[model samples]
Target: MGEYNMMITEFPPGYRFMPTDVELIEHYLTKKVHCQLPFSSLSPLFQHIDANEFYNISPDNLVKNMCVDGGEQYFFIHGDKYFGGERGKSRVVGNGIGYWRCLGEEISIYNSEGDVIGLRVNLKYFSESSSKNNWTMQKYRLTCEYDTSDTEIEEWILGRITKGKRNDYSNYF
Candidate 1:
């Protein structure tokens, strides 16, 4: 396996990582949200969702902002549906469960071959809700790029989860 770095640059303000897809899913599930990206990417996406914010916020709020104005390019994975706006529109991808919107400008990430290794999608959301009556349960899209031949993206996500666990552990001990 080739060693690769899975670093993300554009996101909300206070994201954190989880160790497993289950953990990542559980976190969003409890918030009444559904995540559609691969568990590997989801973990790190959450880790850095809000790395620049200073206030305590809910994951849902963070997710909401991802869909608001100018929040599209911040995602690592893109959704499939397109939300129309003055800048452009957003689209939802991933079996109609995820979304991706354009953030107005396209940024490129290159691979070892100097080929564009990563693609960006604006934020989008799903229509299904984890709860039957909760209208507040809205889904947010992600922006991500992956290499079918490499596992660096997954490992990078796992690293974020590990770091989060360590931080959580330190607080209790």
Candidate 2:
């Protein structure tokens, strides 16, 4: 891994591109779901990939793929049925190597008209062998308002993942 990070965009220096839950669902996901833009335009600026595959790679490679320097986290539009259902979406956070467990912090998303648009949930990645938690993820699912004849709403949810915090004690001065 390199000692520093670099972004491949022309957004000037030190321009952090951090997006919020509302911006994610409303601005990005909603547009992607409703607009049905051309294939060339369909790719999100944040890029979409399987979350499980994320941890398998090295940090520098992840940083290169992410192409952002605002934060250590990256976002994606993952389509896994296991992560959506009920008022709170169900999720499959594990692959053959490890898994991500939810911390149970589900928040309701509301628009300006006070309409419930979606739900936001948080999760932490746990290593089976080390038995340690070291990564974090936040998922947002749009309610079934945009369901199609052949597809369910759960198939188009968005997720954001980042390195997690360890409870290592550096406090107690």
Candidate 3:
């Protein structure tokens, strides 16, 4: 990876890497789902690997994406199913070490017309024991209103992952 990536680089390191609700919906997800931004442009911020592949990633590598929010950032390709018939995840994504646990309620991402663009899902990486906490991932996915197909869902994923020093649950609590 380059020294720094994305328009997000304009801000200083101490600045919060997290985006507000409006910024996520208006700037990132809308542009992403509506074809305003090219796939190449979005690729830098996210990687296509599944979360299970995450364990192979060195801790230092994951730590490199430090955000003011106190977490290192990461991105992974979210799949359609887990094991056999899970609703929105796969067992392999975090099979052994931990899992991407969804936090809070799913908020609707809407365009100016009030049409739902997608949903903002906040997930945390946790170890099997439940005592170990890893990272927090914020993902934006196109709503069924736009494309209900699994393939489309796979293609339109964009995630922001942060691994902070403290595993604070304030955002969810």
Candidate 4:
């Protein structure tokens, strides 16, 4: 059969697509990190650090409440949790600017009474990119505790869409 072509209209300048959280989780978070969205996006460091709601605590509160006293020099706080009849903190220490692997993951599911009900294995990344000042990654894995068991909830892997690929899609359309 002969080749067929299609035409696609482009949006005007200043117009953009806003992805829903579910869409972002499914497409961007699950697939890759370096994938470009329609608009200029913030760096991962800013995104992660700026999001206070995710951990149910603000940055100020984190620094005030969870900091390891004098451990702030060599380490950055990751999270603080009160669950599963246990309360603890998690952090990542400076190991130089390089790849840092996830040795393992722990998930604690708690009931309303703050008691452990379920636990399970959660997969983790073998390695991730880290700089002296920031954490950047091609791919990373996340685990979550659920009613049933721990779940491998998200993976951030990076893939590039090259100029040729863009041209191909434009021409194909």
> Against the hidden true structure, what lDDT does model 1 obtain?
0.31
On residues 1-173, what C-alpha lDDT tens digit does candidate 1 reach at each position? Answer: 23456565566676533222233223442222222345464443443332223013323444553433222212222222332322344444334443333345434434455654333222223344323211121123222444546533231111111101122433532
Which residue pairs in candidate 3 have backbone atoms (N, alpha carbon, C) closer than 3 angstroms, thus clashing? 52-93, 70-164, 71-163, 71-164, 72-163, 82-89, 82-90
Q: Which stretches of candidate 3 lie over 4 Å from their true place?
A: 1-18, 30-45, 48-95, 129-134, 144-154, 165-173
Which digits, one per residue and each the tens of the lDDT, describe model 2 over residues 16-122? 55656677778867765664433344344555566455545433344455433324444455554445323333344334455556677668888878887878877
Query: Candidate 4 residues 63-103, lDDT tens each?
Result: 34322322111111123221111222222323321222322
Cα lDDT computed for each candidate against the true fold: 0.31, 0.56, 0.54, 0.27
Please give the TM-score that candidate 3 achieves against the real structure.
0.54
Error of 4 at 143 (Å): 4.2
Winner of 3 and 4 under TM-score: 3
Better candidate by lDDT, 2 or 4: 2
* Better by lDDT, candidate 3 or 1: 3
TM-score of each: 0.24, 0.63, 0.54, 0.21
Question: lDDT rank, highest first?
Answer: 2, 3, 1, 4
Residue 140 displacement (Å), model 2:
0.8
User: Model 2 misses residue 89 by how many Å?
Assistant: 11
Q: By TM-score, who's the top model here?
A: 2
Compare candidates 1 and 2 on TM-score and give the better one.
Answer: 2
Ranking by TM-score: 2, 3, 1, 4
